[model samples]
Target: MNEAIKGNILTPSGWLNGTISFGERIEDVAGSSSDPMLNSDDYILPGFIDLHVHGGAGKDVMEGGDAVHAIAAIHARHGTTSMLATTMTAPPEDIDVALAAIGKAVRQRGKGEARVLGAHLEGPYINSGKLGAQPNFARAATIEEVHRLEKLAPMRVITVAPEISGHLELVSDLAKHGVRVQIGHTLGSYEEGVAALDHGATGFTHLFNAMSGLHHREPGMVGAALAHAEFAELIPDLLHVHPGAIKGALRAIPRLYCVTDSTAATGMPDGEYMLGRHVVHKCMGGVRLPDGTLAGSTLTLDQALRNLVGLGLDLADASKRVSTHAADYLGLQDRGRLARGAYADLVVMDRDLKLKAVYIEGERCDLNDA
Candidate 1:
């Protein structure tokens, strides 16, 4: 977006009326305004970035096709500009196919939806004890499997159980391939979790939902996320993790991030939805088991933001949980901030926090279907 579009700039202090100048490409941020302009009526924070999102608008990223394209558009409408196509815990072949699909979208440059930086390979490499919705048959990746992914050369982030056999070596291999490793779906102790971090595990995937609860003596996976100063992913639908737990997780983990971890059930009516042959029934704000074991959420990041604000969190702080912090987890320096040099990929919202517009690579994306 050239032609010197100016608006209210949201700084850490507060909203300031200023002109944000840009260069030829969306990646360039140059120029300054001595005299500020525009009103401070709403926010101008960085756009939302979701590192874990399965699918929405009745489309599954695993289903391939235009799933990434469609889900991206729908999510952008709710305030996500850059995101990862979260893969479910599936068979090795299924995972490979899903990841290849994500690679296609990245190559084609998906339209109107959130820009796909890479794929978040959520499973086939996790502890079965905490596999809430994931199929138990799939477990942590072997050294050979990790090496195969490296050979594929696809942009991939992985979640694994640190305590699982071979995962420590897998973590090192993945990190070598530039794959971001996260500790999730695990029964790992705090010590093991910390070890994974030392080995290259950068964050946690949906920290409390599938992982073991924290204990006074044991200090399980959640304990590791809380004690370590690394980023912890949370589904802030307020159902996946309790409101009280959210507060505590935030206090425990210095960089707690919000992710949808949503399924195809999201943006669809309450009914049976397929999450790779597992029948996920949408109930309330999430998908769950018949026994009420909470599956993935159906909540949007926009609602997550509202939940944070209603919980008395500052808007900027809440926005960063999805945008800035998640971006940091993915190691994406060019995104997560609305500053001049960052990609113009952004979401504009109204006072009610409803999404008004999305700019992807400087073009205004039409989110009518979302």
Candidate 2:
């Protein structure tokens, strides 16, 4: 079935008052701002792509069953067309169970759900001292262990502390296998950070949060990222990071993107939720531990877009941060932009930036499902 929509469409070239026609893939886009029917306040943009997602709708990804499905559905309602099922630092057995579920979801995407691209192994290979909100399962990365996990499912992204023993070699090996290695949950020095990037780590996870801070002289991991990284992820919930720091990262990293790092508490009312083995409380519009250490987040990508805009970024730049750059980081050309021959994944928003409609691979999603 062919479907067509007319509005202010964002494209690679720029915004156009256009009509986009599609089925499962975008067939055509044509329009002019001078057209008489350009009075509508709606804006059509590419569907959001989140590289980090733990869970949503009261289900934790670590729970491993129908939880990933529920998480996908809820995030899709918030205009996430695709996401990686992120896992926390846990024991091998627990990780295996979670990866099995993510693999199943990736192979079989449910209706009205965001496409589960793959797994984002966020830990079990990080610094225990910098384990912010993550459990105490930090360890070194071994190719054997990584290969074993890879067999269960494709790992599109993995966060590791570069300073861990033998991880620099591991980073090179994983990068060769096409995995997107990210630096995070570490107390690595600035020199080590640059060395990791030189070896193969291409991005920073939740920049300025768990990693080391920038110092005038010491220039820690954050300094390494600020000075050299081309890509990094930020939680745009306004709770995780200050707006000023976000602006600084914006100025530093060319492809700085936004992620939820969301837990099961997302899209749910304030309450207790599971983030792996830890019990995280969602309250006051943020998720945190009992001692008030920030856990994951309750942010959705749609809200992430709005938050970016609120931080003085124009809509086009904000859209790229929440959608395009994340896709680029994963080396996906078709999923991020709305172009001819691209997947028909996009979101329709009103003038206020609230979602009016969402399409995932040409399938319209129920906005109220979350």
Candidate 3:
């Protein structure tokens, strides 16, 4: 059955007061801001795509099984239509188990859940010294091990510290195989970061958090990311980075985007939670380790959109930060915009950005979907 939803729809070109008709795919966007078809106190926008989400609803992606569905359902409630199941630094055996489980989820994901596009391996190949909230599982990347992981599941993105031994070559190899390479948890200098970009690293992970900061003289990994990388992900929950720094990054790199970098603490009341192997405390400020290291966040994409708007960005620009840029970074052509012939993945929210409903392939999804 074809369905039409009317409201203030954000199409790729601009806003239109119209009705969007869809089945499995977007059939068309009709009507106009002046002569609208259906009227409501809702705003329609493309569903968000998160490239760096750990978990939510008290479930970690590493837990696998129905955990994937639970997390997806939780985020979908907050406007995420799809996300990459991100993994943390862990022992080789642990990593293998998580990878195999993620692979299984990807293959057998249900229609009611957010699409698990693939895996974003954020660990094991990073620099130990800059491990931030990651445990002491950092190491150099090897082609043999990476190839094995890829066989188990599609590795969409991988974070590596370029200064690690044999890592630049690994970056080149992974990039050649079509996996997005990101620089993070690194102690590399600006020069090394530029070299990584030259070799195929296209982005920075959770910019300005785990990577070195920019310096006027030395210009570290943060500087290289601002000065070079085609795209970068920022945790803009107002806790991971200051609003001023987020504004600066927005002005500097047009392609800079937002990621939840969320954890099991998200959507749950203040409490302690596990982010992979480590224990994190979630309280009034944010999710952090007992020692006060910022482990992750409880921020949802809907809140991310509001935070960006709170920073004075127009709604369209903020939506782009949460949706379009990430999709473009991942090379996904089908989503991230409300254009004709696009996937019917979308979110419905009030003018305040409070999520009211979610649609994945034209199917309304709720917590009950789990």
Rank candidates by TM-score, best first: 2, 3, 1
Tens-digit per-residue lDDT, 81-108, candidate 3: 8889899999988788777878887887
List TM-scores for all candidates, in order: 0.91, 0.98, 0.96
TM-score of 1: 0.91
Best by lDDT: 2
Score each candidate by Cα lDDT: 0.75, 0.94, 0.87
Candidates 1 and 3 compared: the better one by lDDT is 3
Stretches > 4 Å off in candidate 2: 33-39
Off by over 4 Å in 1: 1-6, 11-14, 22-40, 150-153
Off by over 4 Å in 3: 33-41, 367-370
lDDT (Cα, 0-100) at 271 in candidate 3:
89
